[model samples]
Target: MTITEELINKINVCTKCSLHKGRTHAVPGEGSYNAEIMFIGEGPGRDEDLQGKPFVGASGKLLTELIKSIGLSRDDVFIANVVKCRPPENRDPLPEEIAACWPYLDQQVRIIKPLLIVTLGKHSMGRFLPGLKISDVHGQPKRAKGIFNERQVYLPLYHPAVALYDPRKKDILFEDFKKIPLILKQIKKSKNDIQ
Candidate 1:
């Protein structure tokens, strides 16, 4: 089996953290292994934990709309979370939980080698570009070293769930979503220039 597949299997059986104890299924994430873009979120919620899939809840539907607005489908990009298993009560994942689960995410990044990683919230953004205020950097694309490979591009955006809770953020989210195509274009141009 490929390394990604193997890692998924390992994640399925992982008990490295207590989060696994309450999980119905460990959402190891899913999407095209060859995708050029990846979307990472914080962790699973009610629907996601039950379904064992990332972004399958109400927030996921909004996320799908955002992806569609960017002229891409879920199949065209990978979707994952910082923690594979859902935290109890959908609370934020603890530092220890993140530490335990990050290796699998790192491996996925190495295997997929995506040119761009879109962090869906502050938690996911912390993995790559920690300490920066999401308000200061949302919609801004930055070049950064990959978790396990060469330099890659990163974008931080508010989680789609934000719209559900606060309608004021919806327009802001859409504006950020619109920047994605432009960001991809620039990345493409830079790659061509380097060649």
Candidate 2:
């Protein structure tokens, strides 16, 4: 099996964290193995905990609309959480939790080798855009080297859940998503220019 598949299989049966004991399932993530882009979120919610899938709650609906705005679907890109298992009461993933589950996320990223990574929340955002506050830098893109031996753009987008709680962010989010198509094109153009 491919590395991603093996990682998924292990995630499916993971019991490393205490979350596994209470979870209905481990939301490993889903989408094309060859996806050009990947979406990373915080962790499972009540809906996701029951469904064993990422982004299936109200926030998920917003996520779908955002994805559609940029001419993609959940099937076209991979989606995973920084933490595969849900924290009790949907609390923010703690530092220890994040530290523990990063291996899974790291392996997934290596396996997917996405041209860009769209971080959907602060937890996921901090992974790539360290030392930055989500409110201050959401939607701004940064680059990291050695992502599969190539630089990859990490776009920190507000989590859909943000829109769910605060309606004011919706317009800005739509505006931000407009950048996806352009960013992907630029990535290809830059690659060719280097050649």
Q: What's each prediction's TM-score?
A: 0.94, 0.93
CA lDDT for candidate 2 = 0.85
- Candidate 2 TM-score, true structure as reference: 0.93
lDDT of each: 0.89, 0.85
The residue-by-residue lDDT of candidate 1 on 25-97, one tens digit each, is: 9999999999988999999998998998999999999999888988889999999999999899999999999
Q: Write the per-residue lDDT of candidate 2 for residues 73-133, one digit (tens) a residue.
A: 8899999999999999999988888888888988888888898899998878877777889
Judged by TM-score, which candidate is best? 1
lDDT of 1 at 162: 82
Judged by whole-model lDDT over C-alpha atoms, candidate 1 comes out at 0.89
Where does candidate 1 have its weakest 10-residue lDDT segment?
186-195
Cα misplacement distance, residue 132 of candidate 1 (Å): 0.4
In model 2, pairs of residues that clash are none
